[model samples]
Target: MSVCKVIVMGVSGCGKSLIGTRLAERLEVPFFDADDFHSQANVAKMASGVPLTDADRSGWLDDLAELVRVEQKGLVLACSALKRAYRDRLRAGNPSLQFVYLRGDMDTIWSRHSSREDHYFNGRTMLESQFRALQEPEPDEGAITVDVSELPDRIVERCLSALGAPDRTGES
Candidate 1:
């Protein structure tokens, strides 16, 4: 998809990885899940149901931002990006980077999360904490907000359609 950069973002288990993968395939770009970039210590903390402080996330965010900055072609990164500051961090020096917000209720996401058997972020409490930290991308942020409740194909189609026309909903 012509050097299109996008971050599929939401809480821990709102299908970021899943949808990000599909989107990347459609766009013919690489897909990276931020969970794969977490430090061992941070992964352990979340695995034990502990919420991370901003300090704990600093290095990780830097690493992701570096990846975004250095990548030569387009890519879709699946990241929680729960806070606006974190999103802004990723955007540094990568102003054209767009975001796809998987907007969903706690119950729907919790149901999807609970069914996972091998994910590191598996705590319900941690999910709640992420929601608390969430800052949905605003209209001016040049983002596409899609419902997570729909079938995956529909979501991907919506993303592709929205992407085909930038600024259709302030997404350029």
Candidate 2:
């Protein structure tokens, strides 16, 4: 079966938007950036170089989960699913939902984040805090982690190829 519902997840500036959009295009699904769902307070907090607490993110995550819950067709969402609990919350929307965890080191992601000119991500402080909060998905989580250093097309290709592959239970 083709990729129907997926989330491209990682820390901020990990190319979630670019890769998620491409993956959505490849899968013929609608794409959404989780940042678009953030409340103004969340944006303002991040803009001021403050890291968001779990409390700050609670409602935002719920909104994103609701987006997943309501979509009947293929859906691709780019979100910073840093914690396992957050991913679990998102999964409550659809149990079969797949995740594409963009894995990258601090230096690489910081480089990318620094180059960006038009986002609320204020400085390295926010990035560092994200690293602190990140809970990389384990083998059992069913997330396919992809390295972000590769070219965009190659990353998308790998995602599609992996998503097309069967899991441990041999179900597609």
The best candidate in terms of lDDT? 2
Q: Candidate 1 — which residues are off by over 4 angstroms?
A: 165-172
lDDT by residue (1-172, candidate 1, tens digit) is 3578899999977899999998888877899999899999999999999999999999999999999888878889999898889999999999989899999999999998998998788588999999999998877888899999999988988998888833223321
Write out the backbone clash pairs for model 1: 167-172
Task: List per-prediction Cα lDDT, in the order shown.
Answer: 0.89, 0.90
lDDT of 2 by residue, 67-103 (tens): 9988888799999999999999999948879999999
Worst 10 residues of 1 by lDDT: 163-172
Model 1 lDDT at residue 13: 79
Per-residue error (Å), model 1, residue 129: 0.5
